[model samples]
Target: MNKWQKIIGVVVILALIVANVWAVMDYIHLADTAGAWSAEITQKSFFDCIFSFRQHFWFYTFLSIIDLVIIIVLFICLWRKGGKQ
Candidate 1:
């Protein structure tokens, strides 16, 4: 695989890992709070205002699917390379 592609793959993989961790932590916090997540008035913006478990869950799910697709493509590329001689 190309060096740049490998770097991108690693970066994306790390991002996916971080995103998963963040989503899990957010879910736990929401659960602990009994789904009473709230955003401060000062933080009221297009992205910050919406606070709901369903939204977080769906967003996480979408990211996960994208991550999986990236991983599969990376693996396929690696497999096609057939390793260094």
Candidate 2:
């Protein structure tokens, strides 16, 4: 039988990589869409882009938090499983 824990670990790493890449891609897109996520309010000042940036990245941030929790939980489970062997 396969070491399911090892498989799960590999899957976890891959999932994290994919998630972070996706987040970064969207971040780039959002920034580009927002003109580098900043706009001129005056010759020397930029408009408030914080809210828009936050709004754009909120879902990705949430997914990262969820991924963190899942990774922690999976590691705990795998550790216990390994210990039993």
Candidate 3:
């Protein structure tokens, strides 16, 4: 990848990390309010709990899956390149 492409990739990864971190923090806060840790809260599945926000679950879920796929594809491409000049 060229310099610009590498920079863009880093930005994208950082954005994804930020988004996921926010979701995790939200989950922790919710679980805390419910008086239990996430693992101890068995009333709902992890996805159900995470996406329990005001019906934007599908949107976030889609974005997360897409982000994961993009990361996987980037890694595969890099592996195939094998450090070629």
Candidate 4:
């Protein structure tokens, strides 16, 4: 791969790694909460609703998968291009 492609690929992989780590931490936090799973879903005040956000584990997983794919592709490209003039 060219220089820019390699840089972009590395950045994506790093971003995915960070995202996955954050997701794991979030899952662990939710798991540790005594009543998190059992909590009732109720309507919140407008301000509370605006500020409260839930994390999406699946999104992170998808990103992680994509990152892995990019890394594999870059490695394969480098291997195939080796020894070329």
Cα lDDT computed for each candidate against the true fold:
0.70, 0.73, 0.72, 0.64
Which model, 1 or 4, shows the larger TM-score? Answer: 1
Decreasing TM-score order of the candidates: 1, 3, 2, 4
Model 3: per-residue lDDT, tens digit, 5-47?
9899899889888888877786566666654564666656654
The per-prediction CA RMSD against the true structure, in angstroms, equals 7.8, 4.3, 4.9, 6.6
| Candidate 3 error regions (>4 Å) | 38-60, 83-85
Query: Against the true structure, whose TM-score is highest?
Result: 1
Give the Å shift of residue 85 in candidate 2.
0.9
lDDT of 3 at 54: 37
Model 2, span 1-85: residue lDDT tens: 3699679879878988898888889888866655654554333222355455676667787887888898789789879989988
Query: What TM-score would each prediction reach against the true structure?
Result: 0.63, 0.57, 0.60, 0.50
Worst 10 residues of 4 by lDDT: 46-55
The digit string of per-residue lDDT tens for model 1 on 20-49 reads 888889877765554335443344442343
Name the lDDT value of residue 49 in candidate 3: 52
Off by over 4 Å in 4: 1-3, 34-55, 83-85
Best model number under lDDT: 2
- Overall local distance difference test of candidate 4: 0.64
> lDDT of candidate 1 vs native?
0.70
Residue 14 CA displacement from its true place in model 3, Å: 0.9
